[model samples]
Target: MPTARIYQRPKNAMQSGKARTDRWQLEYEPAEPQRPDPLTGWAGSGDTRGQIRLGFPTMEAAVAYAEREGVAYTVVPAPTKTLKLQSYADNFK
Candidate 1:
């Protein structure tokens, strides 16, 4: 006599690491790095265009700042500012 065996799908698949990874990819896989806006956040000269600052959030924003400010931006400034505005409104006073 011969016996046959059957395989069942895993019930735990949904909670598995692969499933988590898949969910992450499906929900919010990160985008390619972009030039970030420096002014939008708490950094730089309230200039939307700024060089790639490690802390501001993105590189695109930095470059835009350079272009807008007419800075020598063959390269991005490393988040360096001399007497950089503590806040954008500081200049208004």
Candidate 2:
């Protein structure tokens, strides 16, 4: 059985911007363990089913895609972080 993970893209930690935040990503959790490549010595997985990432503008779109593909998925909610308001004048104080 394949399981899909749906999650919202987080705003950049250093800088908060709308860029990339509106998109949601649907990814497949690898069902098989990763193995090292014999020649290159790089870790790789034999199962490629869940390696692709599908991005959607809305959560509904992502969910719909998963449903249409007959993929069992679990939604991972984005963490909430509150920003404290500040003013440039406060720096002079």
Highest lDDT against the true fold, candidate: 2
- Estimate the overall C-alpha local distance difference test score of candidate 1: 0.33
Query: How big is the positional error of residue 27 in model 2, measured in Å on the Cα after superposition?
Result: 0.4
> For model 1, how does the per-residue alpha-carbon lDDT over 32-85 read when each residue is reduced to its tens digit?
335446667533343322332222223455445445655443432233224544
* CA lDDT of each prediction against the hidden true structure: 0.33, 0.88
lDDT of 1 at 72: 42
Weakest 10 consecutive residues, lDDT, candidate 2?
9-18
| Per-model TM values vs. the true structure | 0.22, 0.83
In candidate 2, the residue pairs with backbone N, CA or C atoms under 3 Å apart (3 or more residues apart, or in different chains) clash, namely none
lDDT of 2: 0.88
Total residue pair clashes for candidate 1: 14
